[model samples]
Target: MPRRRPNGVGLEVSALGLGCMGMSQTYGVPDDRESIATIHRALERGCFFFDTAESYGPFVNEELLGRALRGRREEAVIATKFGWEYEGTRRGALNSKPEHIRRVVDECLGRLKTDRIDVLYQHRVDLEVPIEEVAGAVGELIQAGKVLHFGLSEAGAGTIARAHEVCPVALLQTEYSLWERHIEQEILPAIRERGIGLVAYSPLGRGFLTSTALPAEEYPESDYRRHDPRFQGDNFTANTAAASVVREVAARREVTPAQIALAWLLHRGEDIVPIPGTKRRVTLEENLAAVDVVLDAEDLRRLDEALPPEAVAGTRYPEAVMHMNGR
Candidate 1:
């Protein structure tokens, strides 16, 4: 039930948002009934910041979210993104051209069943189209009253600066967790200086920080983690070992490791809002509980020492996907 304001954007949301990606794709099979139920439970718990994207399930995820929010729209803040060129679930090249951005926003509005998007982000920077143009396109949408705020995902500092100059970016969604701290080097400072809030995705190391995570090989081929380097081979072992610190702290605090991991993010700054994805009510409740798990200075120091930026084992993404991060 805790609330956070992203970089003084004047937009407040639940400290922990619901990441609606895995409910429709990537992690495993789709479970619409449960996904909707989880979203409802999130609302009941006062966790009203829900994140989705046009690329998630290529389109179905937004539809599912729309269905979930049908009668309760005003109670939740919806955040979704656009960037990838996808048809159904078959993804193609990245496209953020002015025309494309306009097209995508219209479709997203339809799928979301909403007139205004609480926050609309460019999923990934489109090198083909200048960042300024991307920002301008979103600015136009804002003027049209289609988008309430603008955001960028996995964008480098330079890109963020350029875009914000054209139009103030309310938030920056990127991969940030105990294992992935690359943003701290430059991106984080830049966004903070610009008063841009951060939305931390994969805050639990994509479930690696949780006890339920299995070796890469144990995941089904359809699971994205099966191909993620951090979850594969020796890297998985090393990362799992690194995450033991989370377990130790959780045991001492009498909290779940997931809570420990999420609380660590919450401790970083109020400017940060983490959207941990889940398709079940149980996991959603557990993640929401992180808002209450306070990490004092000593606990913060121990966690930082335990999983220092360099300590994490593999790159956060594979080579091909890594290239698209705009960092």
Candidate 2:
């Protein structure tokens, strides 16, 4: 795996990183053994960047990654987030207060089984706690040697600018797959102006761009896809048809649709790094190999036109989840 510098400060990571959320929750049952093996395989393949959040599995995901990186922690760059409040094991409302941010990083350090976090994200913008305060809190942590870099997830453009003013944002984690292009208009340009790298989550459109995607109803009630707007009703049918362009392009290149989807993002810019999540080693290998699947001008054009922002139906998230994006 090749490395790319997402920021001018020389933060280099694998071209394609592994997203560790699915290993603990959302997509399916927890597979601790396999998830650990997948994480090891990623490191073995030279992909050392792994993404997880404090809210994921309400805290178990960080613990799981901690266990996986136990002896080999020196070879990985771990990125975890905070912002959501937790009462015991249950997650509560968004709370990015300065105190909350410091407390979460301390707790996350123990759960992650590491002394310092490679990258710390806000998880989601907290409207109540000003962005400057959040950034300042993270800045203090960075100065104290608890955090190496600062990032924001799903934050608005103005908020990003304001936060960066307080503390330089090294990366912005957001959903920016083919099906999710809402950030291109304002967010991308704003971050690019500041030279903040993009850490694209859901680079596979939550599996819709892949061949294994099933209807929303097909997923278990506990799965997040069950409530995703793009996976429901007529939107599923329409989105499926729109995603066919990926299959067509994959067929032409003799590569998997997932690879095509990831390759497209790679071609978008060197500043963009897509962290596609998977608990299985086989799937992990397939996603990492996307770095080698080159997309030409024609391929890029066809993909962009096939899935325009308007062509895809339904909001990226359900109404309740969309409420958090206001920041």
Candidate 3:
């Protein structure tokens, strides 16, 4: 038999979902052929949910997913995000305007090769636009059979409440991990209360907690990890120390550091699902096996003490990216 279904609001996904961001951009140049193969591999392994964003590779990622899911669409659950507004020359910034939302969903459907999005998330909270307007737009898509579920990314508790009033949010995607526990204070409570599934992105702490990621200088020039404070300067040294603690626990348990990081999140909540990004088969396998590494109460407490919420040094994103979150 397969693993138990992880419930997310009204939808059900495999216990583990694949994060398709790395297959498009972020880490380095990605080979489309290899990325497609990886997506197929995930399906073969029984992973039903795949995540991609319009902002990833600036629309190129959705196209990539479209190709990968072409004839095999029914084998997976496809989730794509919108909300970034891009004019001809300039890159995209967030725009959840009702008109723009309609426009972008058409474009995303064209790129995704699908009639309806399985789960549609607003890439970020657009403060200038009312949450009700955004919810109203997605709600219309649901009624029109263009969208199955609505979601939000990095939205605060207040915005989530307001949006839920308009249309029940199916999921809330945010950066939550052992190193980054800010969501635990308010976001998790709100989500649990409202029965919204929490999709934890960057759940491996952008590979910092995985221990396989080396120094910033060792990363490729195109890699975005270089821009993260935890991967730069003295912060890298401090961050490595935190990984060392995880490594120690993993060694004793005979598991990889990546598994330890992911397993911790699994123990966090049944409603919480982690999407750890990886480009290679080896890393992907390492991540998938995390579901089997059950962490007992003692294990959870020790791991928490080893890397406390306040212990992670520096911010997860740069100043500009940081400003974009939690609106």
Measured on C-alpha atoms, candidate 2 has an lDDT of 0.93
Using lDDT, rank the candidates from best to worst: 2, 1, 3
RMSD of each: 0.9, 0.8, 1.6
TM-score per prediction, in order, is 0.98, 0.99, 0.96
Which portions of model 1 miss their true places by more than 4 Å? none
- Supply candidate 2's per-residue lDDT for 248: 98
lDDT of 3 by residue, 51-80 (tens): 998888878899999998999988878889
Worst 10 residues of 2 by lDDT: 318-327
Clashing pairs in 3: none
Clashing residue pairs in candidate 1 (N, C-alpha, C atoms within 3 angstroms): none
**What local distance difference test score does each model get?**
0.92, 0.93, 0.85
Superior by TM-score: candidate 1 or candidate 3 = 1
Clashes of 1: 0
Model 1: per-residue Cα lDDT at residue 249 = 92
lDDT of 1 by residue, 79-164 (tens): 99999887667889989999999999999999999999999999988889999999999999999999999999999899999999
Q: Please report how far candidate 2 places residue 87 from its true position, in Å.
A: 1.1
